[model samples]
Target: MPESCRSRELPASLLTNPEMVRACRARDFARVFRLVKVYAGIYPSMIARRCELTPSRVGEVMSGRRQLQHMDVIERIADGLRIPGHMLGLARRTWETPLALATDGRTTPQSVASDPVAPASLPGAEVDSILTLTSRTDPSPSMLQALRSSIEDYWRRDDQHGGEALRPAVLGQLRYVVGLLKENRPAAIRHGLYGVAAELARLTGWTYFDALQYNQARAYFTEALQLSKEIDDRQFMANVLACMSLQATYQEKPADALALVNAAQDEARAAPGTTPRVLSMLSLREAFAHASLGNRYATHASIGEAHRHFDQIQRGDTDPAWVTYFDEPKLIVDTGIAHGRLGEAATAEPLIAEALRRENSTNQRGRAFHAFWLARTQLGLGKLDQACQTATDALEPAASVASERVAGHLREFYDELAPHREEPVATAFESRLRVALPMRVSGSPRP
Candidate 1:
C-alpha cells in the first residue's frame, strides 16, 4: 500500500470518540468523512483512490448529494478511512476476538455497541393500533411543499454538479415518494402526489441515463410513465417520453429515438394545455435523433421547428418545471453539437464557444463537456495548440467529476490527438493527462 493509504490503526482516541460513533450510527457520511479528514489527516482524493471511487463521488457524499447505502461502499469506507467496523454497522473489527462460531463455520464477532438498547416489541393489538394511527396521517400539505422544494433543489444541483453526483439521493427521494402513495390520502392529495412522484421518477431516470446506467434509467423511465398515466396527465407523460427519446438518441438507437419523440409529439397534440416550451424540447430531441441518423435535411427542419416553438414561449408561461432549463443557450449549444457531429466544425466552433461563454461557472460538468467539444472542434480545424490547451483545460474538471459522458469525450479527444502525438503540444497534453486523469495512456501507438 502507498504511504498515503490510511492506516488501520487509527488513534485509540478517535476510534472511541463519541461524536465519531454517533455520526456513523446515524449514517451521516459527511460527518464521518470530515472526522476522518480531521483525525486521519488524509486528502479526499487519497480516500477516493483507496476506496476505488471517483473524487467527485466522495465530494457528493460529503455534500449530501449522494448517500452511502450499499454494503460494499460502506465496507470500502470502513477499510479506506480506517473507520471502526462497528461504526459502520459492521461486525467487530478483524483485530477483535470472535464471540461465537456458527455451525456453518462462520465466526460471529462481538462489537462494542454504542447505540441505546432496543425498544421492547409492542403487543399485537398495540402494533395494529400504531399501524392504523400512522396510516391515518396522510402526507401533509407542508410535507408535499417541502418535497417539491427538494425536487427543485435536485434539478439545480444536477445542473451544476451533474447527474452522477445526484443519482443516489434522487433515487432515495423517489422511493420515499412511492411509499407516500401507499398511504391513505384524499383524492386531491393523491393526484398532487402523483404529479410530484412522476417528476421525481423522470428526474431520476434522466440522472441515471446521464450516468450511463442505461438499464436503471429505463426502469425509472418506465415507472415515471406509469405514474404520469395514473394522473391522466398527457402533457407530463409527453415530457417523460421525450426524456426517454433523448436517452435513446445517446444510446445509439436513432430510429427508436425518433419513434419515441414522434410519440411524444402525438401526446403533446392531445394534451389539454401543453406549453410551447415542452413542445420545443420535444422538437429538440427530434433534431437530435435526426442528427444521429445523418438526416441533415430532417435535422435542420426539426431545429427550425424547435426554434419557432421556443420563440413562442413568453415570460410567465406556465411551463413544466423540467422544461424550464431549455432556453436559447441550450438550443444553440445543442445545435452546434449536431452540426459538429456532421463534420461542420467551422460552423460549430463559434456557436459552441458563445454558449460556453454564457454558461454559469458553477456548472463544472457542463463546462467540462463544452470544453471537450470546443477542443474537438479546434482539433478538426487543425488548431493543434488551441485544441491541446482547451483539452488540457478540460482535465481538471474531468479528474474530479464522476461523469461517464465527460470521460467518454476525453477518451475520444485522446484518440483524435493520437496522430499528433509527436507534436510538442500533444506530448505536453499527454503528460498532463497522465497525471490528471485515470484514463488509459494515449502516448504511443500499439504495434
Candidate 2:
C-alpha cells in the first residue's frame, strides 16, 4: 500500500491528472490501477476498500485475473472512482452528472430539454439509441396503467425481498419512465407520467438507501423532489424530503435531518389536503432526528405531535400509496426506535415487541430491524440472556433478507455486546452474528 494514499480521496497529486481521467473514461480497471501506481499516490488497499473488494481481489482485477463485469460491482467502482456512468455503458451516473454549461456560461442543473429531439449534452446518436432500446410507443392510458402496475409490483416485491433484491428492476423501470417523459404527450398523461416517475424515483432512492448506498439514494431522491416540484405536488415533495431526512438521520447527521423534516412538514402543510397520516410520518421522522441529537424534550414533544396526527387519520381516506403504509404498526415501531435511541429502553421494549408481532411475514426487513431493537432494548435493561436470545432470533430473518439497514443494526448490536464476550451466551451469539453479518471496513472513500 502506498503510504501517501492513506486518505480515501484522491490525493491532490492525482486530482487533475489526465491519465486518471483517460483510464476512467475508458473503463479500464487495469489501466486505472497502473496509473494509480505510476502516479505513486493511490494504494491498492484503499481501492479494495472503496470497491468493496479484498486487497487480493483488487490485485486480481489489476493483474487481469478477474473482470469487473457485474453491474453492481461496476457501479461501485464508477461511484467510488467518480467515473462517469456513460463511460461504462450506463444511462447516467447515479450521482449528478455535470451539465454542459448553458449559454449564460453558468452550469445548468436541469437536464437539457430545449430541443427535445436531441439533448444538448448528447455528443452523438444516443437520443435515438435509448429510444430504440426502450422501444416505447406514444403515451396512452394503457401504457400509464402498465407503468403504474409495474411500480406497484416492484414496491410490493421490495417490501418482501428488501432493496438489494429489487434495486436493479426499479432502476430499469426508472430509466424507461424517463424515456417516456421525452415523448410528446397530452398534458394530463404527461402530468400523470411525471407523478408516477417521481414515485418511481423515490422508490428507487429508498431501495438504494436500504442497501446503504447513500450517494445513489440521495441523487434519486433529489430527482424525485425536482419532479414533484415541477408539478407543484407539495404532498409528494414532502414525502421525498421526509425520505431524505430519514437517510440523514441514519447517516448520523441529526441537524441536517431535523432541517429536512422541518422543510417536509412545511410542504405538507401547504398541500391542499395533506392527510393526517402523512403529517404524522413526517413528525415521527422529526422525533427520530431529535432522539439522535439527545434532545429528550424535543423528541417527546414530536412523538406526541405525531400520535395526535396519527389519531386523526380516518380509515378509507384518500391518500397516496406511499403514506398508506404509515399504519399503527409502523408508528409503533418508529416510536420505539426513537425512544430506544434516547436510551429509554424500557419504554421502547414493549412497543418494539408489539410492532414485531404486528409486522407481516412479507415484511422480513421490518421484522429483522424490530427484532434487533427488541434485543437492544433487552440489553439496555440488563436482561443479558434475553438480549442474546432475541439477537440470535433476529439474525435468521435478517440473513434471509438483503437489507443493509438490518445488517447495520445487527452490527451495532454486536458492538454493544462486545464487552460481554466472555459470557457463554454472548460468545455463542457473537459466533452466529459474525457468520450472518460480517463487518465492512469503516471509512468513506471518494474517488
Error of 2 at 271 (Å): 0.4
List residue ranges in candidate 1 displaced over 4 A: 1-137, 438-447
lDDT by residue (197-310, candidate 2, tens digit) is 899899989988998989878988999999888789999999999999999988999999999999999999999989999989999999999999999999999999999999
Each candidate's lDDT (Cα)?
Answer: 0.77, 0.78
Q: What lDDT score is found at residue 204 in candidate 1? A: 78
Q: After superposition, how far is residue 392 of candidate 2 from its true place, in Å?
A: 1.2
Which tens-of-lDDT digit does each residue in 1-447 have in candidate 1?
Answer: 554333445677877898987787556788887887798765676667656556766776788765555566776677665676655546444544344442335555444333223224323544544644564436878878888898999877776667665655665566557757875788888988888889888987887787888886888898899999998998888888888888898789999999999999999989987888888888878888998899989988998898899889888789877777777777788878878866779988998889988977677778889899999999999999999999898887766666777777887888888899999999999888887863445443320
Estimate candidate 2's alpha-carbon lDDT, on a 0 to 1 scale: 0.78
The TM-score between candidate 2 and the true structure equals: 0.70
Off by over 4 Å in 2: 1-136, 434-447
lDDT for 286 (candidate 1) = 89
At residue 76, what lDDT does model 1 achieve?
Answer: 67
Error (Å) of candidate 1 at residue 295 is 0.7
